[model samples]
Target: MKKLTVLFIAFIMGFSGALKADEGMWLLPLISKLNMNKMNDMGLKLSAEDIYSVNNSSLKDAVVIFGGGCTGELISDQGLLLTNHHCGYGNIQALSSVEHNYLKDGFWAKSLKEELPAEGLSVTFLKRMDDVTQKVLEGIDADTEAEERKKLIGENITAIKEEASKDNDYTVSVKSYFEGNQYFLIIYEKYNDVRFVGAPPSSIGKFGFDTDNWMWPRHTGDFSMFRVYADKDGKPAAYSEDNVPLKPKHHLPVSLKGVEQEDFAMTIGFPGSTSRYLTSWGIEERMNVVNNARIIPRGLKQDLWKEDMLASEKVNIQYASKFSRSSNYWKNSIGMNRGLEKLKVVDSKKEIEKEFTAWVSASPERKEMYSDVLSTLEKAYADRGKDLKAQSYLIECMLRGTEIIALGTRTLKLEKALEDEESDEKVKEVADGIAASLDAFYKDYSVSTDRKVFSAMLELYYKEIAKEYYPSFYNDVVIKKYKGDFNKYGEVVFNKSVFTDQKKLEAFLADPSLKLLRKDPVFIAAKSTIKLYKELYGKVAEARASEAENNRLFLKGLMKMKSDKVFYPDANFTMRLSYGKVGNYEPKDAVIYKHYTTLAGVMEKYEPGNYEFEVPERLIELYDTKDYGQYAATDGSLRVCFTTDNDITGGNSGSPVINANGELFGLAFDGNWEAMSGDIAFETQLQKCINVDIRYVLFIIDKYAGASNLINEMTLVK
Candidate 1:
């Protein structure tokens, strides 16, 4: 694995020892409710006063925390917003029917009146978070059962909500961290009125969907625009034609001054989660047991999906979206596992734990809990391994191509069931159930992209596993039905299977003659394979359980290692702030990255015919003309920057990259290839985050697209 050049020594020395007790202290100082001086010193150029003066008051107003899907920012007083294009792709797809494919052509509301309101879309702003560790874990002890512990925690959170709401109007949620070592009461204001404003074509936003995901040197413009809507009273309300654009309290200023090497930077958004505190045992299991058992099968599924995509257009339509998403995540796991192996993250964690355990041994009270924790974790891994395997199997087989067919059957069954049912409520329940499943079923099977992966995995399962497990379809089945040779069978069943035709299958299920084929040899073979796969999955679950228990022991040791000295939990898919300076990277002996990328480089990477690097003609023309005026390229090109030490994960997509002044400089998107494991472990040296220069965003908005009306609203700081 490549070593991180900047913070290698500091990270190696262990976070507790290498970092000051409050190295992240400069992040949130207590000088005042909104301290400008401290925030400036910490790397924000904007003062607390500036944040407040800019229509936003308090951290709550300035930092809007997107809930459920992903985090985004309110960029306009009239509630114009920005987020990852991938995040908004679903809505765009939903709006697009067969005749109007917005995803293919892109969607831009010519004016505010043309904006489309999407049902169920929401945006949440964090109003406040008070430390509630004591309140949450008041009576909890090491001996407490997991279920009892869960119940108590829930009750305490409910109580906290009741108390916090006495005079204030907000929603409260108790968040857990560091294995129950800490808790926070988060108060939020959720807005349900959000509309799709604009989006670039998927060809640009999702360029190189699988090819460039998790790999660096990326050129994806993964961004989209939305607007928050509110009633005349300025409070959140359900979507209605009468709703008006929202007036936000805070909106980030577009900074064209841009970032330079070693410049201080920070990302303030909700991070999904990480288990950097897991035990060496758990890490090893993830690296080996989990990855080996699940990731390979997933890759096989993806391959199958690709095959089907090429074979049938209908399959492409039904499964393409789902396969894209599934494969996108699958590749992350593949890279994460590979990177962990290269970085020896598991080994490093073990070494760190060795020192921690030794220190804990000095204290009698701490030593008493040590062995139990380790033993419990070991048992948990053995117990949980099967569950992990089961999940993988479920996603690959039962939930992919075949599952949707089953779903279509259920839908038809419900229609038939309702045809005879007299009770309106029961019929409604059945109809609703089918509708709910249909919504997911369409996305899940994504016939266009995912069928090949699903069917291929089924075939591989039959071929790879022990012969005893698939007796019926092992030797004679292949010989009689598929010519006995395993190689030919694999090619026919996986590489050339006709099941990839989603529309045909749907028709067959609808046709009585061919519908019975749904129960034919191929389907029966897959079903039997799934049954066995599920049993093995249970074994994997047991292993994961043991591993999780072990991780708890390891985390416990680290807590004692720090002993009363404060350190926040690693990450928990919750909002977190990581601060560091921008810097170049030496990925290898001969490869040195300058910590920035220019529009020229984007052009260099562009290949007109290649899907991975295709540049739009308009964007290329603008770049050639040097049309960027106020949003001029910072370094004489489209400025894409890199940073050395911000911890983020999947959900941090489209997070604003801000300077010490809190000025928006870029949008956080991809991480470097060497740092793929940073999703699980943040190595400051190897884990540099790649971002889209805010300048490029502005230039595209101004010169390329000619949306000056939108550009004029931003508080731009050139």
Candidate 2:
């Protein structure tokens, strides 16, 4: 493994080779050594240091991890941030009410005073990253036990973090790359005073909703704006009236020049997770077990939520964010399964494994290291198959599916604290914490809606999952007491559980009695479900430990075997850079996709009364008058969305699509449905990143919303 690392470094530094346009999520620091020449040749006008630099401000300074999952970019000196609307949906929903519904009507801060403070929302700037593989793996060798190696690695990582953050206000994490074949220490400075600046209404932001979520020829103006504020000393601080807008070290200049066919494009952001290194067996399990389990239950839940949402506007506002979050991945899973089968990814993985096996057999040393890797993975996945499925169902149905159960589970900690030390202050502290969370939880929660979803999910769990795998409480409470009636069980739980009523919960918390909590049906069910989940998680953990060790060896062996191939690490929500071009491809026979879509297409598809196709009156008036202002394309058409061959996944949402000159041109929000399988296997032909054109985002902000304050903050380039 050490030799392989040396060779890998040598390979990266020594080669002045051309890069393939269709693949690779390259590390930013390695850009100068490994990718600058290729990128320069492809049309990059900036130096590698211009992309990522430690000595000076660069593009890296402009990008941040938006909240927990998405990516955002600093587009103005005043910390004006740009991300996808969906990425900000939760905050938007949180701030929304029936009277002042931002989700439906949209929001634009006319001034800094109007910018709403978003509690608990944050943006983390990457301070720097260091290759810490040697430090992390110190005193570890081939003979070390997996558990011991992990402990050593954990200790080293902790020590490194402590040393790095001694006097600095930074959060540090050591992320393993290439399936633990390499490690990097990432440092981030997090700003907690994030504010909501602007967003288009859902009619435009989420135009097609579920129907066109992952599809191409997209026209959604899926962009949102936010701002980061800093304290008097220009440092991150909690929200305060005295805080000023952050003066960013580097902010992207927005380009209205627009993109063309094969125009050089790149996306810089934290892509969440990609399992491109998974074996054939892993892909099968993902498709049949994980994706299947999520898709079915979520689809059922969404259907129930949708019916309720459409029936009442208040319910619609309440459930909008939750339904969107659930349905987005549910649709993605459906598309991924289709793409996986259509692309024959499993067979392709099998072929690769055959090559890997053959390469290992060619040398005794390689055989000793990697001969058991494939077999170990096969057996581990095979042995854990039933449990894995059970775990998935358990999480989807019992934990994630039922709102009351999830809410009740929160009390377990309070119950434990009460049991251990019966102090009034401690009880009050726990009760207050629970009380603080209840408003937010119950804001979107509907008893009637959740009851229906609970019943449906429980019924599905009972019908689909094995009887033995059901939570013991289900058999004990539902079958034995309620006579196998899920509806009756749901009714009883909803009616009796304190979790169902905020007032009841508050009253109970005022008294602070563990006896009452232990007897609570919802709490009882939660305890049972959690216990079973932990037991199953333990089994899965054992399997994963063995699998991880074998996978590391396998990755190391594969790297040695295919030393010629440039191996990029699988995404783990760390910063990565992938460069490509604005181009399009055919999904199948006789169907060609263009590089971009225009507002004309949006109007063409517009049906005034239809929920998915409705266009805002102001937008329609702008289109009718051709009032595109300075944001229109050369053809006088306003480009709403475009396609790029850039590699992206879930967490890449709101990632800024940069041009050769490193100007922000688009916001990456989704992937083409035809290439949903790209996460597991990059389908160069069909895989395309769906991005909202920066011009359209500006058009909506400036023309439709008439929010000149936002336009004034941005650094626009023609």
Candidate 3:
């Protein structure tokens, strides 16, 4: 393969055409050459360099990868970070209990010292990016065997990543693009000392709960604040009392100016994944196999969790984040399947495949290069269907359905150290880590709750999947020992397993016995489940390889066949800029959804003592008095949330919505339900990015919380 020069990227991305609407998640390094002119024409006041300059502190410096998959931006020079409240749900829930339930009631730190350090929370900054296609695919021609090609490419990527991160502590990754036709090397700097600052209660932050998620005219105040702390030398460090708040290189100035219809708006975020170029067969498999797995098992598990949560506040706080995490994707799967069928996406893709097949047949060279592409993809998807379903079920039901399996898996590291006859100090290190984490794990765990979930999920797996795919223990222990009753097996396991009780786990850590752990019921069951998953995955590995290569080939051919069409690579969890305008959409006939929703809408949905729609008394009093302070629109109405056409998906949950100038106006949180299929297929007219108005965030911070010290930290732009 020849080098994909920077000039080539500019030519491909900078092309002028109207192939589609604003349907792109563009890489920033080439934005100046590709999108600056179009962005300026759409009312942008800042240059591409202002948005993404690696040499100087720019807007990219302010944007960080919050937690694992979400995007966050620095709001003040003190490294005060702003992200979606849902994105911070796990951390808040972890720190909550019946005594101080931050998820039920709100939380605010009056001063820096009062801010609580969030465990397992880290923020990552993109240091720089480079086009490294040539470096990654340096070896071989068309004659190279597929396995050899994969092995050589892996070796090449490892070498490039090692070389890039050799001199600095920055993490490096090489991401493929255009379906492996291009590659980019990204460098990131991570800071782990992130502290929880403030958040509204679920009543406000999660106003509508499950019903309002992925819906339009949203009134949720989905915003949260955190502060990044570093060592005295301004270097990233572990949490410590001596650490100080980081002085960010650049921070976004808050804008009180409200959004208007057709106003230019943009969002930069780390969108997780998209299958925009997926084949029809793949789509069918996704809907029937993969998503079906998520829908059925998760739906069952969430129901069990909700019952316990509603019965007791303790269980509610313990499983708050767990339930939210599970339900978010469960609902998304349902909506996506419905959207895909409604839109006839499979039929449309079939039409495209027909076109590609005819185009390939017209020329001998094209035929030789692409004749088997469709057939190969079709066969791979067909072959992997059963195994894929089994794999997905294994993950949702056996692996993630219950918490005990994950807990059991965590002990493997200590087991491995023990088995290898490593140094006593090494074994002690592993044991100590597990001991320290036991409190945190059991803090949110409930043996009864998990035992119920365990029985139901395993039953579902047994009933749904083929008998051949059952975990080895299920047939042996569940059938022979427990008369095929998963409930009986589950009850027995939880009753006897050391992992079920914190004190038992602590006792194990003290003794450090290998024989006992090997005999542990939970460990034995987890190992069996994991072993089945691995075996299934290995069975479909070849099909996966074929599918991937064919997908890449089909895309490469499609790009060349339609050279004049404007195309942007699918999102791969990288920092990308998507430019669009703030606007409303008509979800159906005779119903035009408005661009924004105000506080009155929240009040309209309010019900007395209702879990989902209950209004706080202080908020109601503030609404009655019309005391919105400095955060109200000129018409004396306080807007809660708004909508935009900016292209975004799951990992974009906490992205910052910026105006024409480089100032924050809203926080991007969810996508409207009408466009749930946007990830697989961009719904140009119906898709909308739902965001909480920045003013509402400020209003809650000032009047509701009265944290003036926190307010003073920001540079608000009037």
Candidate 4:
């Protein structure tokens, strides 16, 4: 690959090499050039090519983009997969029901025949990657207009992606990097038939639940198992009885040898997003507008969901995934806000910006190139605050928070089809698609719980957001008729709307008519809300474009200004490797947290009737008997979870924590609460990757659950 361009180089000038091991989510393709020597210095035994090689079966082959968002690793020749229990929580909940409540209890498939099919779940392996920045910006220059630059880049990406997948069945994507100053092409091979093999129940898997979700000194056994299947010829295929377990190119050798403080620890996974390059204005917007919207509405909605879930097993099974998904980030937003404030992240960013400004003012050439970058970004963000806040509240309060509104939004396609006077066959195709989805949707839906969510979320939106951001229905109907009582309006809509009842919806779809659909109150609200959101999006688009272009220029110049220091690209759901040492941190004055937690800690937190801290009976029995088998540390304690300084974010969940010899010792599940602000600003001293000890995973499989079949298949190292 062509090296980065620069007008001049200061050549380190006493700069510390490569931003330390504890920071940076680095690209694999650049590891050898940028990070190999440093990694080797940190005690890594494997070569860079051993970890990521396009031509050979390397560690990359063992990793997959689990489902849509998290990471998973192959553990056995039979295609057995392992990831965080919370990462697989949604699929597990989808497979559960009141009759066979796997979420409350647990599931263990004794043989291949018994593994449950995870219908919507899929695993994707990265085939390779290529640098395509030169191609993407071939004809672009300083004189090019913003719109023209965007169009040319888009065309170049399309051509690059087309040529990359010209004669293959691979999924190829061209993603921008370094704030669109550079780009890369990623290729992936996706398999559709993934099956659930085993998992510990919530008591163990989600031991601390929300109370301890993003906290440290965690004792959760947060691991789950799945298996990928393919056709006899080893090609990706749909779920079928004839399909056999995949014989993967590589699989991780699980290590019962365990981990210790200061040992080499590394993770390779797809981290979702980070704003390490984001300006101070952006940080403020993230904290006040985006997080506030989520905190206020989601917390209110989740409380309602939790009440119903506690009252009935059916409701619990139905809403478990939804609640988990909502609460995970709701609590995250809370913690992130707290961290940002406590860490003074905004002031830190502003100081950097001030330094950048002074650097630019020194030279006329630099002044011309970077003069308006900061001002442009400041004005862009300042002007769009109201629109962004309105959009965030709109999304959290109605679009996502209310189940029935989300379900109702699905009918827009059918509505458009009928309005456009499409052919009967074409309309039937659209209607058939909606009808096919209903079974799965209604399977895990509870009308009573959804109605409560609808009422609470709608009331919050109406009272909190400005009138101008309100949907058409609130002014046209609610204000005029119900005196702006959101609960009454919600009740009327739920009572009369077919979207609230599956049978009624199916009947409406049986002989669907445009007139009847328009008459529905839920439909009106959904349509209006979506239309307003689009309008809000449009209002912010221009400012967003200005901000994006300026941000790109700012980064390009900043890289130039700090040419001696190595810079890693911010995360954007791409495979990245982060290495650090396994260690502990002192979060506060005179209080130090240890590097790891154990089964004894799990027992200490156990309360018989407490939902969040409840320990399963069988797990308690094993702990009392000290039946940890061979998974215990040298001191005879069963290590549950440990901490590392490896930089990670949301999507890094389920990443395998490999040791110096490249053997799996832990599974990265959560990041410690002290460094929740690390996504925006890496906290080297306080940031820690909370991981579930792989030995604990083995112990649970071999001793607690008696699923020795899984344990026997894995290649364990002592």
What is the number of backbone collisions in each predicted candidate, taken in the order shown?
69, 0, 0, 0
Over 550-643, each residue of candidate 4 has an lDDT whose tens digit, in order, gives 9999988888787767677899999999999999899999999999999999989988888999998888889888887788899999999999
**TM-score per candidate, chains pooled:** 0.81, 0.98, 0.97, 0.98
lDDT tens per residue, model 3, 472-581 = 88887898789889888888998889999999899888778889988898988888887888899897898999988889889888876777777788899999998899
Off by over 4 Å in 4: 1-18
lDDT of 1 by residue, 1-718 (tens): 0222122222322333344211231213212332333345656655544433223364336455543656787777888888877777767766665466666666777688878887667888776556676787767776777668768878988898799888866777787655655577877788998888887766667766777776556666677888898899889888888989888777777677877776777776676767666767677767765566556776766666667755754455455555666676677777788788888888787787677767767888777767566656656765665455445444454445344334433544444444565466665666555445445445435543433443455456455444444435555467577765555554454333334444444444343232354334445445444555567666765565445444555665665466544344665545555556777777778987777666676687777766557777887787788776766554455664444456677777777777766677877776667877875666656676777667766666667666777777778786
By lDDT, is 1 or 2 better? Answer: 2
Candidate 2 lDDT over residue span 589-703, tens digit each: 9999898999999998898778888999999999999999999999999999999999999999999999999999999999998988888988887889999999999999999
Q: Where in model 3 is the C-alpha error above 4 Å?
A: 1-11, 14-16, 412-433, 512-515
Candidate 3's displacement at residue 31, Å, is 1.2
| Model 1 spans with C-alpha error above 4 angstroms | 1-42, 45-56, 59-62, 65-67, 97-99, 142-151, 161-170, 307-320, 360-363, 400-428, 436-454, 463-553, 563-566, 640-644
- TM-score for model 3? 0.97
Report the C-alpha displacement of residue 653, candidate 1, in angstroms. 0.7
lDDT of each: 0.63, 0.90, 0.90, 0.89
Ranking by TM-score: 2, 4, 3, 1
- lDDT value for model 2: 0.90
